[model samples]
Target: LGIGGVRLLRALGLNPQVFHMNEGHSAFLGLERVRELVAEGYAFPVALELARAGALFTTHTPVPAGHDAFPLDLVERYLGGFWEKMGTDREGFLALGLEEKPWGKVFSMSNLALRTSAQAGGVSRLHGEVSREMFHHLWPELLREEVPIGHITNGVHTWTFLHPRLRRHYAEVFGPDWLRHPEDPATWRVEGLGEEFWRIHRDLRAELVREVRSRLYEQRRRNGESPSRLRQAERVLDPEALTIGFARRFATYKRAVLLFKDPERLLRILQGPYPVQFVFAGKAHPKDEPGKAYLQELVAKIKEFGLEDRMVVLEDYDMYLARVLVHGSDVWLNTPRRPMEASGTSGMKAALNGVLNLSVLDGWWAEAYNGKNGFAIGDERVYENEEAQDVADAQALYDVLEGEVLPLFYAKGPEGYSSGWLSMVHESLRTVGPRFSAARMVREYLALYQKGQEWAGKARGEQEVLRAFHQALPAFYGLALRVEVPGDLTLNGEPLRARAYLEGEVPKVLRPFLEVQLVVCRA
Candidate 1:
């Protein structure tokens, strides 16, 4: 994919000054660029430096084990001849990605991208810090704070995720150009439109209920269930109930079964005075047995509790189902283990449509939660073990559901709608709409691209400086260096001063290339 992507660009007469690699999956494009430069008469080292200067890498995986690696022999078998063409031996090429793993020494794609990119970033602020620590060994001379990895928090395309009815409503309230300036919070502040907003939301919820019922009925028919069972599927979820949506890849860290920790307590909440139902839709990776087990457990628990009518898991989750859930649900639920979730964007999509998020204080929510806009599962405290963390977070989820979320949702005004809930919906729209829009994300990336172009230009100019220095080597042979230090260099409360100067004539362009350093040591 990586090699073909680069060649395709060249074939189309498109020359991009900077290449932004979304993940290690595309790290091979860097090697292809180096090969192209080598074929154009540049030495391997110079080509590598040029490629590194122009490339930018963004790593989305926070866990070390999540990275892609291959056995040494497998890499040698496929890329053996490719490396030789770059004027490097097999060992030298393998050293670019060589790392020690529990299994054995392997070639890591992430390590290659990091080594071949001038700029690297993560998908969120916390992720950036996590990545710095994860790859700190690569820059042993620098502190963790000085690591070059930065973050550009992921965002969603607002219009694509926003419900069509709500989009037209906004177009009428604000001008048609409202979407053009989605990064501005003022664009979402629709004063005195509370009742209309609630009406549109209710209509969307009804639409979602119809879609869910149709899907459930079709699924039951495929399973060869009785005609009576298929008829019962049409009445699964309540349209008027407080619906909570949980949809994502059923990874274990996401804790898809967290709500089922205490079946009785969950039952009480589901059968409480206020109506509440859950709609779950996701698919586990085919190879992940644990993830598949979680999915099976969710279905089994729904049957065991005899709450099939209140809780429904939609099969074959896709973009169409995701849009329905995000647009029609009263609340969006995300319960991933803290710090393990690398900037989830589904919650952003839901929040863009005024669906209040109930999530752990991780990923973008860690930074977006302002105490009033949404509900947080727990404080930012990770326990010593996963089991303890799950217990605490699950308890917190129940507490928020019973103590805060339920009350605010059921607190209706004289006009027959929850005014407090509307306030939170407004807050979510005002905050998330501007900050988490694709416009802002793209703007941040454009800034990074500009910086990458500057780095590449500087690298090319440095090569020019090297050539000039070689041509003027005879004149530079007589150059001398002189240093001056303050006479009162002491341990007072002020910084000591020092200066260095070239004691011979130097070319105008070469003056900026000279650098000086001062080293301090403990006696």
Candidate 2:
């Protein structure tokens, strides 16, 4: 009866010490816990006091514009019954799940989460400082740096997702111990996989290339391009030749069009003496035509350079294609504008299969990179005009390829084979490749999200109900909602006329509404 939301948690077989919310996503659970205790014969004041004892929250944004707010009436509609049943007044109800203060006149999820959660955080160290200044209103008494938005830098789950063959190849490179002792990825260094593992990796890469070639032919046939022509073209592809792959979701921020900045520079890089080729495989969201258009422009360039057989665009890409391209490529190209990328995962996969990175300094690459480990493309200065940055970075990329990478590929010996590129390949595999992975990231998430083993969200069930209020899975609650928007209660806020669209559904299969305090609800 005294335990606030811990009662619900205990009911579920999880014993709780605290609660944790990912974002504004779970703020209402705080209020729900308080109300549960209040309903179970505890005074509302005592329940409210106990509610703040053990909780944590995290936010991911740094600017005020990123926060969300809703009309006050929206909160009233959902939680009105919960507060009324708990005998709490309207002012008290408005203050339960969130709060907004006088100075800034903002309703902040970061604020609610920080003030309510016993511990709170931002996703990175730099972001945590930015967030402290951004959400200083939540803790009016504390200095910005002292405000408890702890930093837990983001990570990925690289191995859980490694194609089994890729994982095996990694085990051979780093030894079985690398998986257990990932924190020090240099463990692979002492064991030293040397040159033999690279050979097996290269052969596995050939197998993946064949699979991707088959897929490309399949897609070309569907596009009304000749299936027989595409099939015949597959035979001409250079599986033994160095193949570069560029595959990621084609968001504009990624600078997917960077390679086309200089026609002459690209002409030199692509049509090399070593006959290096590219396989571009990625998809823009249906709404994102800028990236899709960039890809189409690239298609035209293959014809322009007269490297049609050498360079190809594999479309209609999915997870399966992503796996193949990562494993098959000699190098994975990621040219996102510097510092904008927030922990790219494709590069990690490439590292696993001994495919080196040709990427700008951004996201995980910024952390994992040694110039010798793979290829680094740009400087860290944030440019005001993106067009200027694109031009500069693209030129740098062109220079690196033409001067360094291509020369290495073409450099021959008495044996009539180039071996210079192999040094960089070995460096990538030994250094940045093994360390930047998802297992390390997942361990970081578990530590930061769990809050020193304080949260029991994995346990607890349902919070207390005053009179055993029941609902169904398809939640057959008998209620009527009819509103004439502009004629009904006006939304009297800034710009004064936010649009109201009325929607109706008969017998919907879920609970109808959610009420949280002081701001908007997008859920």
Candidate 3:
């Protein structure tokens, strides 16, 4: 499909200067480009070099299974003739997707994409570091921190996701320029909200409650529930309750059932005088029966614990439901295991609508959390085991809910208003609204595209250099180099030295092939 996509674009007379492959799924585009270059009278190796210069790839998955791979026989069956047309033999083409292990029959799409792209990146800062370690095999001579991948944190489309009510309010306060400058904190103008803001906020909550009740009643009716039970949906959730929303793709690493780890403790918190309510919605993959079973268990616990009115998971989650939850909920919850989430963007949508985030510091939360703008789940600690991590995170959730979240939320001042909670809401809106919008993301991409185009143009202009480098590829294949750091290494505002031991068909003046990085760590 990826190869066909490139062909289709060419048929339409589209000459893309930079090929941005969002993931390995479309990595075949790189191969197609090389084939095109070969047809234009370039040698196979030189074609690969030029094609790589014009390619950029972004990796979004940290887990191994998230990557796509295929059997060698399958690749040959599909692409054998295609490679043959480019004057490349079977083994040479197969080597493009080679795995490092002894059992190397499978071809990794990610490996092929990494080798072919001139630039690569992860979706967030932490994910960039994680990606470097994950793909360091491609650059064995470089230090871990010196791996080439960078990051551009994910963002949300503010106008598409922001509530209409909030949009109107923002426009009134900051003028129509707010729409164009949604990433600017000054454009939000939280101070201008005044008393009318809370009134409208209450109305938004009431509207969300009505929307959920209507959807739930219809779902139950279709499922053959009693009419009496269906009617009870009208009183499902309180509009004024401290609502915490947890919604995303139903993956186990997200730990959707983390709060239910201790039912008794969760019950205690929910049964308080100023009780809290939760809104949960997500869909498991079609083949993910275990995820579906977890969802069923969660719903059963809600009923068995007699907390139906305080919690509900809407059916067939969609964009409309996401808008309702982000706009109406008082708090947005995300609990992905550390370093597993690439760049979760739902919480950014929630924060844009003045919803406070209570999330584990992973993905974008690692960069966004400021101790006051949002609540943290746990300290940045990597536990030795999954069970230990779950226990610690659950306890931290309970502690924050009881000690900080609930207290501030239910602390009514004048006319039943929690000024402290409102202050946090304002801060979240002010800080995150501008920083995590699609406008900023597009600008960053444009800057990177300019850089990529310049690099590709240089490579295209210097064909002789590319031909020379291609000729050197075989000698560089199995070369090994060792480095030794000085014994008295220190960073007390002084220089450090290291010696390299290169042993192979070596190239003199090896400055182009060698790089040095000094790593500093606390004792």
Candidate 4:
């Protein structure tokens, strides 16, 4: 369908260039290209093989459940004629997991991805490793060591996350040179400037918080939300209070319950003289009714626990609110199970604005965290049993807050505001902030794209540039699968004939694989 859609879009005269296949949903673009070539009278073999170099495929799914697939009947109905045209006998198509998929009933999107693309990758280093092993069945030519799946860890856009004025303040103080040489000698020099600089950073954070709070309140009023609660939220807004923001899709894996793990501890922090507060927001997919209910339950907890003054679960979150939460929060809290998260751009947003992370040892945090900068929810929960992990993680979060976070926020140096908070802010920037921005990510991509293009060639580049793609393979191998019949030769127990791709002529030894096309199948 996507292949058809891409073809339609091109026919509409939009001159679109470069199709980024977010996932397998757009794999049909490859099919579309093949269709285009065929329409122009080029053979299927030339089109499919030639189109490989230009396209780039990035796989977001590390798990089998993540890929899309369709039943054999369904495939035949849509592209069955196309497959027949390409000479894909049952065994050859099945060899590529186009049939009899144990992962799913239908051909997997990941399977299609590995087989179809010249260049393919996972979203992060760990994911890349997982993906390589997962697809080892297909690339028997390459050992696990030789597999070609690459990695491009996700990153947040720095300019999008950091406050423009605060960023400019840093820019002004350090000069535009700071962007190029974030780790430069002069950049580190700014750390030594005592109290005055810390005051400026904190003041900027406070003002940004005000802007976000006003925006949220106004939006709520426009939506006809309770005016009294909106006013109450306004009154509760304290630029000076230790604010924590927890916002993301309400997946059960994110462990949203970590906040209530130790009811007494959390209540103490909220009830304390300084008054810590958390602003929560996120959406569950419309189909994930359970996850949506979990979010609603969290809202009920706010009322049940009388956390109305301290906790607010804003409903119907979107990109606009995301900006406010990441920019305004003193700390960004994320507690998903280990490795489930591929990469979290939200934490990166929080990092650039000097918001510390209180997160699990997963996602981008796995690479960026140091114990000194902020807190990781657990030490070995990343490697623990489910029950043990939950208990340990719950405790780990409490320890960081009660033992570390509270003291640092409220601590006053003998010399005052310059001492404690200033130290944490400076350390977080040096350790977490600079290392995770998009500028660093883009440089990694440029290198990857260049190398892939060289191997893929000019035709590959054109597809990537133009978003046009191949519809089918030109001379790809196809294998025949059949069951045995006693005293009779059978192809998968059906009347047997097979086809295989060979360099020149079909051979008997490879009859298990046939180069001859199956012109028909008997019932």
Q: TM-score winner among the candidates? A: 3
The predicted structure with the larger lDDT, 1 or 3, is: 1
Kindly list the per-residue Cα lDDT of model 2 for residues 206-292, writing each as its tens digit. Answer: 876687678767777777787577766576467777778899888777876688888787877666665677888888888878877
Task: Specify the highest-lDDT model's number.
Answer: 1
- For model 4, residues 1-523, the per-residue Cα lDDT tens digits are 3677776787888633334455766776766655666575555555565545545678876566667877766766766656444444554443343634545657666666566567777767767777788777677866685587877878666666767666766776667667775533346444644555556556755764675566667767877889785786576456777888998999777877677867887787677666587888898988988888879878888788998766777766888778777767788899887777777778877766767888887766776777777778776335558767777788888788887887777786676562666666677777655566676667776666675456456654444323222221222334234433356455475655444434543333334433333443455
For each candidate, the alpha-carbon lDDT, in order, equals 0.88, 0.64, 0.84, 0.67
Range of the 10 consecutive residues with the lowest summed lDDT in candidate 2: 458-467
Residue by residue across 432-502, what tens digits does model 1's lDDT show?
98999999999999998998899888877787664465566667657887878878456858787888887
* Residue 118 Cα positional deviation in candidate 4, in Å, after optimal superposition: 3.2
Q: What lDDT, from 0 to 1, does candidate 3 have? A: 0.84
> Residue 187 error for model 1, in Å?
1.7
At residue 69, what lDDT does model 2 achieve?
52
Candidate 2: C-alpha lDDT: 0.64
Model 3 misplacement above 4 A: 100-104, 473-523
